[model samples]
Structure formats: C-alpha cells, structure tokens
Target chain A: MDKQEEQFVKAYAPATVANVCCGFDVLGFALDAPGDEVWARKKETPGILISAVTGVEGLSADPTLNVIGVVAQKMLTDLNLEHGLELQLHKGMPVGSGLGSSAASSAAAAFAVNALLGNPFTTQELVVYAMEGERLASGSAHADNVAPSLLGGFVLVRGYDPLDVIPLGVPLDLYASVLYPQIELKTSLSRSILKQEIPLKKGIKQWGNLAGLMAGLLMKDYGLIRRSLHDEIFEPERSVLIPLFKQVKDAALKAGALGCGISGSGPSIFALSPSAEVAHDIKNAMEKVYAGSGIETKSYVSKVPEQGVRLVEQSIYQTV
Target chain B: MDKQEEQFVKAYAPATVANVCCGFDVLGFALDAPGDEVWARKKETPGILISAVTGVEGLSADPTLNVIGVVAQKMLTDLNLEHGLELQLHKGMPVGSGLGSSAASSAAAAFAVNALLGNPFTTQELVVYAMEGERLASGSAHADNVAPSLLGGFVLVRGYDPLDVIPLGVPLDLYASVLYPQIELKTSLSRSILKQEIPLKKGIKQWGNLAGLMAGLLMKDYGLIRRSLHDEIFEPERSVLIPLFKQVKDAALKAGALGCGISGSGPSIFALSPSAEVAHDIKNAMEKVYAGSGIETKSYVSKVPEQGVRLVEQSIYQTV
Candidate 1:
C-alpha cells in the first residue's frame, strides 16, 4: 500500500525515578524537569531509519545500538506498518545517571513512532515496546522506569508476566527533591554490589513499606509517606556505593523533608516534601551535605509530572 | 470505681484466609463462615478472668497461654481499666487446620472486651492487641490473620513495627471457596521449611503480584486478580506438606475458578471466584479431587465478609 500523505511527529518523554525506595522494582514516577525528545517522519520505504542524533555525548549513531532506535524498530516490526519511518534521538539527561535516561529515550521514540503511525496501539502496548528497549540496556525486562516514563505520574508495575502497569493517584501537592552528584554510577556496577538474596525479615519490611507508601499517596497522608519511605532490602546494601549517603539523607530529614533515600541504584539521592517550598529547602539541605563532601551536585524540585509522553506542537519550539 | 452496669457483651470474629498467595505475612481477608465467639461481662474485680473454653480441642484454658486470654489481658493492661472482665471463649473452627483458628478466638476476645469496656480503643488499636495474641501463639508479631479477623474485610498490614493495618475496599461480588482437608499442619512446621532468603527475582515477582492484587480489588478487575494471585516464593516448598495440593488447585482452576492456592500455611486450600455460584462449583470440584486422593475435606463457600468482628444480641444465644 502506498501512503498518500507524510506526517512529522515530535514527542517528549519525561525522566523518571524508579524503585522509589521501598518499592524496589515495582514503583516509579515521572519527573517534570529532564527528558528526551524524538522526532519522527513517515517515509515511503518499509523499514525504520535513523535520521539524526544529538545532545548526549559519546553515543553511537547506529540505530541498532541506540535506545530510541531499538524501541522504534520494535514498534514498527510489531505493528507491521506499511509505511517506513525515520527517527531523530535527542537526549536531555546524562546516560547511566539512575534517573531513567534510557527509559526516556525509549519512551520518546515509542510515543513518537506510534503517533507517526496514527497510534494503532494502546499506551500499555507502547510501554511494552519501550520495555524492550530497556531490556536491551539492562539485560532484564524490568518496567520500573519504562512504565512510568511512558505513562506519566506514579506507575505500579504489578506484574511483568503479562506486563501489567497500573497508574496510581498521587497527592498533587507532593514534591520531590532530587540531587544528581557529578559522578558516574553505571546501573550494572551499582546492581553488582547487591546480594542476590534478601533476608526474609527485610523483605517483609520492604513490602510493608511499599504498601504503606501506596496508601499514603492515595490517602494524601504525608506522615505515612514519610514513615513508609524506608528501604531495608536494597538501600542499606546499595548506598554503600555512594559517598556520604547517610549524612545526605539525615540532612534532608533534619531539614524538614518527610523522607530521604537513594534514587534507584544511585549516586543520585532524593527526598520527599509536602510542598514546593519545602522541596526547595530540602534540595538546599542535600546540596549542603554533598558540598561538605566536596561532591558537586545538581538539584531539581518538581511535582510529579502528570503526563508521561506527549506530542509537541510547533508553538513549543522555544522550550526544548 | 464500681461499675455502674453489669452489662453483657458477646461478639463474633470471623475466620480469615491469610498469606493470600503472594502476599504472605502482609495481606489477608475475613471469611464468612467458621469463626469464634466470645462472651464478656463486666466484673467488680480488677483483672481478666477466663470463665470457659470450648469447641477447639486441646487448647489450654490458661489465660496467659490461650490466644483469647492473652489478647484480653493485653487490652486490659493497655487500657488500665478499673473494672475486671470475664470472658467465655468458644472456638467455632478447628485448631491446627491453617484456617486462622487462633486469630478468630483472639479477635473475638478483643472485640468483646472492648465493647464490655465501652470501646476505649479504635478498631486498629484492637488489631494491635489481637496481634499480640498472635505473637503468643506463633512467637512472631504477625498481623496477617488477626487484622483481617478484627477489621472484617481485606486488610493490608502496611507495617508491623507500629502496627499499621489499612482496611482496603474489596469487590462486593467476590466469593471465596475454602476447603479444610481435616489434616493437621502447624503454622510453625510449615514456616520452618521456607528459606530465610528468597532470590531477588522471585521477591520482585511476589511484590508485583501483591501490588497487582491490591489494584485488582480497588479497580474491580477480575482478570488482574486472577493473574496476580500466583505465589512463587512460599507455596512451592510448603505445598509438599499437603497431600493432593496440586490436584485440588488444578481442579479448581479447571472448573473456572479465578485462582487457587494454599490458604495461610496449609491443610486448608482456597480458590477465589467471580461469583458465589462459581465459588460453590469450584468447591465441589476441589472436594472431588481430594476425595479421589482418599482425603476427607470440608468445604465452605461465601462472599468476602464485609464485617470483621461485631456485637451480638441476646437472641443469638442458641447459635453460640
């Protein structure tokens, strides 16, 4: 079938904080600040083509090797679209930063390619295609980052067997204060330090906290969220990789933050605050602690992004 | 202070299905049949007195050792009430059958004593006291059975340190089919076979299913509930202790039951269905499978009880 008209689509997928302390590989939410954008155009040819790539340093231009390229190719193949597509990958966040950099790129590509193909699949299908890209990078088909990055807001990866991702209702006033220290922490290296087996006692605590955290968000109980934002299973073992992790977390709590812990597998750490004002205060407190340790830090304070991946209009050309 | 009234208070606490497949130690729901009833009366004396114990075989009448007595004593000490209370413990369920028999008695005692003292504590506080009773029986402070028994519905044990029990909204049409195999399977013996360490992969699957189950109940998604009811962590090992466990579970599923697995530790097995008719049908299917294995089984089919523990009028004396 010959395509009558060609369409250009630009979409953005927000960065996400996966794991969310006690939730481990189950919970994540999109962030407002850093994200990836993909530009796609319909072509007469029958295969996905990589047109351009920019923003991130030291990345291969090969579509087969790139996150966005890999996700776009999978979507095209799965949908069996008659029209070929070309994609441009643009990264706004640094790679391997624990802030879901690859997920953002994959999500943006999936969202853009779907739009370019007239959105033949549901958002969940798009998430699955994006997860394939995540699998390419992580070697495991985990959806903690990809689901939230594609769906926006807080997403609970209920089960991966059939790929169930449920969006959770979050407190609108709640804010996150994230600090990305100027250091490289590859997810593989961070994951390597983790024990394959978690103590049953700690596992109980982690799941309890996970449930409590969900209840807290749904009921808008800040105190419960604060108390429940503890990770006995993963954080204690993984935080050893980050310098002054305990001090930074303590400073955030001392500074009136509800809770503080590692952001995914990290050199990045985050704290939860009830208000934007408190989130900024918590960011400053975290920065101060990191500054004391002579580690340069970049911080962000934003509410949970309600939209995951969205089409960008020409009017927004000034923004991204 | 002398009591102004010597009023009588009798309450019934429903039996519970704890563990709930993947949510071992953290989730449970009350069943409609086979529960414990406690009769309480205000006394001028300053301590708790156990007047009678019946129904369950081989249980000590000692207040300190018995679950009902232990829970009643804790409630009295916690409240510091001047008036003494006398309790008559009647167990309607079999002991060591893995049907939360002890939890029912403990919950009934807690609910009755609180009513006898004019409701000094909230229902959640009552759950904590009942959990203390469970600790006396299991040597662990687990709220899986006691919380749902006392609260009467699906309960999430979000945390046990300060004892946070959240009552969840359940599907009103959901029905449970439970079968007790008339065999003794002590909770301790069942628990002893479990590995202290679970592979992180299995742990991920377990928590995912737990979150999925909660989402299913909240969203009223039956398929999600069925898919999420799997248990990869505890059931594989514990099921070895129960004869014909696999055949019974498979038969229930074959009869169109949503999901089937061991209810708590075992000797009893349960299957969830979309309706009461299916539940009853599934029960018969399960019974046939057990009968083929030369095992006697008693089956009960009822909706998820919306009420946990409740007061009874004098007209119910014949039932007790």
Candidate 2:
C-alpha cells in the first residue's frame, strides 16, 4: 500500500443559495464569497477531534456535537480508517443567517479530510458525507445546500432515491445579490412554519413554474425566467415571517432585476439580475429599504462560483 | 373594406398525449395520426351553427352542446364579427379513451374557425379557444391537451394565469406506442378519484421528476428521460382504474422500452421507446396481455408531429 501523502490539508467550501425561486428543495447554486474554511492535520489518536473553532461564537469544541467533527468521524468510519485527525473550522459567514453556514462547514471538513487522506472519495461521495453533518444540524439529510457546496455551480437534487444530483448549466450573464439582515432565522424554525399540505390546484402551478425555470435556465430565456421565478406556495408562507418582504421584492424588481426572492428560507433575500451592474443596483436598492428599519444588513453581489470544495494547501509525503 | 377571403376552410388537429409521465397537467405532445378535422363555412345568418356532425355516431347536433359550436360562439362573440358560421364535426379518435379525443375535436374546430376568419388569432390565442372547447367536454379548461394539439410537437403548459404555453424540442429518435382498450373512462370520474391533498414528501419528488423531464427533453438524454418519466402523485391514484396496469408497464420496461404509463387518465396506455422496432415490440407485448381479457384493443405507433392545426383547404371569394 502507498503511504499517506498529505499530513495536513486546508479546503474552502463556498456558501450556497438553495431553493432558487420556484425550485423549493430541488435547486441550488454556490457563491464565490462568504464561505467557510477548514484545516485538517493528522493525529496519533484513533478518533477524530476538533481542535479549534473560529469566527462563529458559542461554537462547541466537543467533536461529538460539532458539524466538522461529526462529518469527519462518519467518513473515517465508512472508509474503515484507523488514523485520527484534527479540524480547525473558520466560519466566514454568519450562523443562523440562511447562508448555509452549517453546510459550508460540513462540506469543507469532508473535503479537507478527503484531501488529507490522499483524495480517496469522489466529490459525490463527499456530498453524502457532508449530508451526514447537515443532518446533525437540520435533523434531515437534504442535499440542496451541500450539493452545490460540493459540486459547485448550479446543482439539481433530482432524486433522493440512490442520491442522484445533476449539475445544471448557468447563463453567462447571471449575477446574484444577497442581503443578510442582522436578525437570526433558524433553518429548522423557518422550515417548521411551512405547511405540510398544499392545495392540489396550487401544485399544478408550482410544477409549471419549476419546469419553466429549468427550461429558462437551459435556454437562457430571460423573459421566461422573469415570469417563472415565482413560488406561489412556499414563498407566501415563509415571507410572512420576514418584515417588509413584499416591499423589498418590489423594489428589486423595479430596479431592472430579473427576479427576486428568498435565498434559502428567510431574512437573506437574493435578487438575480442579468448583469453584475444590475446586481449591484439591486443590492443598493435592497440596502435602502432595510436602512429605515434600524436593521443593520450586510450585502454581497457575486457570480456563481465555478468550483466547489477544493484544497487550498496540501503537503504530500512521497514514499521512497 | 376587404372582401371576405375564405368562404369555407377545412383544418386538421392532431391527437396529443397529455400529462407525459411526471408532468401532470403541465406537459404534453402531439401525434401525427388518428386526429379530428373540421370544415367551416361562413354564413349570412346571425348565429353560429353546427350544420352537420359526422364520423362519430350519436354526436349532438346542437351547436351549444358540441365542442365546435361552443368554441365558435366564444370566438365570434370575442371578435364581434357580426357574422355566423356553420361547422361540421368529424371525430376520428375514440371518445373517453384517454388519448385526448376531445382535444383533437376542439382544436380542429378552433383552428378551422380561426382560419375562416382570415387567421386573425395567433396560435397561442387559438389555444385559449381550444381550451374553451375542452371545458365543454372535460368540465375543466386545462391546456395540457389543447395546447399540444393546437401548437404541435412537445409542449409545456408553463402557466395558465396569463396563458403561457411553450413549445419544447423533441428528440429525433423518440417514438410512442398508444394502445386504446375497448373500455370507456369519463374524465370527471377519473379526476374525482384523485386525492385533494398529496403528501409533502411526494411533492418534492414529483417536482424533481418534472424538472428532470424538461431537461431530458431539451438535452435529448434518453437515459435521463427513462429515469424521469415517473409520476409519484397522480399516476398512482389514476392507474388503479385501469386493468392490469402494473403487468403492462413491467412488460414494456422488460422489452427495452424507455417508459410506460397511462396516457392521460385510463383505458389507454402509452409506452415510449427509443426505436420504432422496440415500440412495436411493446405494442405486441401489450396486445398479448390484453387479448386474454377479452377486450379488443387498437394501437398506433407514430412520431411526435411537427405541426399542430393547419388549413387543409380554403376558398376565398373577392368582390370587385
């Protein structure tokens, strides 16, 4: 057997925008900035450990409860590896902010550990490992966030049976404007407020919007994209929790933005525009609306990131 | 003022396959054979009239009760032409056989009337008129059937709010086998059997399949098409009404067919194959199973038609 190559590795996993407009739990894409990083190092012990956690306060140092630690342990157990590892998590994004904070951490740790272990797993397999960590936080294994964070670009979680995710093509001119308000919205809390049963009449329109959205993305038809970026069922229910939701959306639409809706669940609203200039304009418009509410907001305008999780640093030890 | 151009116009509207697998109420495609035709003649009388109905026995002679008459009345009132027209109904497909029999008749009448009026209406507008005719027969103004029959080829009824129907590209090698059993199934009765509320879990999978189906058609990925042609919500409820539904579907899949399911509602089953040879094999397999049940069945294999409704003949008279 070949000796272990990398003694230490660091990886970055970008934050994701899940449920893009009408897609609900089926579509998501990764962002270029405001992500999470993890640095992993080999240890002599047989159990995985989290030696440090940074950027996010009140994070648990106990490996059993931490997302990075949980996912690393699962990967090692699956591969039947006896080597131990220590993970240092640096959270650049806010927690409980609908920015996929937990998913970024889980994806980074899975990716960093896999790189440290000579890249033993495929990217898809790493997604499963990251999903294990996501289940630690959301109580369910949903690939919407982790898939994009692992696979990069726009990703569709086509089916859960056998875990199939298809990478979708993005239009060249598409840009995103994300605004994270200073309020905390837990993923589980936002998910809990959604209705379990929607009326059958609305379901037909939702499916149509979804199909139209996919076609629009593939065909690069901006008019169809503008018309189809509507979620009649879930958006109405979730937007009720956010203050001034309709006004913000209307402002974004009035500023030449193609479509505007919630990013994942709530508070962090995203607007998709045809150009980066328009995306910045949307960001400014969104900031103006939140200015009067005494709510401090952080905003970003970015393109869809081309790569997902990748090793930033690696040191391979060659066997003689 | 321009003199009347077309005194008599005859048009043909092809049969359609509605609710293609997972896209219930949202997707359909037109077939080339076994359709309905209508002949319209402008008259000096004040009211729209059905002069004669043929090709289907026991069809109503009343203009209001018939699909052609109702649609023509709606069109004349909307246009305010201050003229009357006579329509002859010719039904080539079986009634209540789940092969979009009513939509073919409705589309032919709508197209014939529009052509008689010098084609004032756009094709999309004609879809709306065809939908009116469909309402008379199915009790619901759904465009899944009418849109495909009016516009031709694979079509997606993206939304009904502003009445949007998108014509999707079809793969060149895709062929369909449609089998109509000698049994009647009412649209209303079949619709009534469906549950008003579906579980949220199934809703996600259904939307994924729908999005996947659209991508599959646009990309012409047959493997993706085979995987995505599954309806988790309506098909399970509606397929129970058909006899030997499971056996027929299994047999088709076993014979190298891509996918098989009830065409629209029940009493007609359709299978999609990658080749004409395999489509005929599926037809034979389906016929073999139904032969023992003592139910006479008729089948057809055809390509997705490129055109929808078209003028078969027209005679214009000019006044100097």
Residues B1-320, candidate 2: write the lDDT tens digits.
24563478888888889888888888998888788989998887778788888887888979889988888999999999887988898888888888888899889999998888878998888988888888998788989998889888888889988988888856556888888887777877888998888788788899998888888887778888888899898888888888888888888888887888888776788888888899889988888888879788988887777787788887878666
Clashing pairs for model 2 are: none
DockQ-derived CAPRI band for the predicted complex in model 2 = medium
Per-residue C-alpha lDDT of model 1 across residues B159-210, encoded as one tens digit per residue? 7677778888465478899999987778889999999998999998888887
TM-score of each model, in listed order: 0.92, 0.93
Cα lDDT computed for each candidate against the true fold = 0.83, 0.85
DockQ score of the complex predicted as candidate 2? 0.75
> Which numbered prediction scores highest in TM-score against the true structure?
2
The C-alpha interface RMSD of every prediction is 1.4, 0.8
Superposed model 2: Cα runs more than 4 Å off: A1-7, A315-320, B1-7, B313-320
Correct interface contacts retained, every candidate: 0.59, 0.70
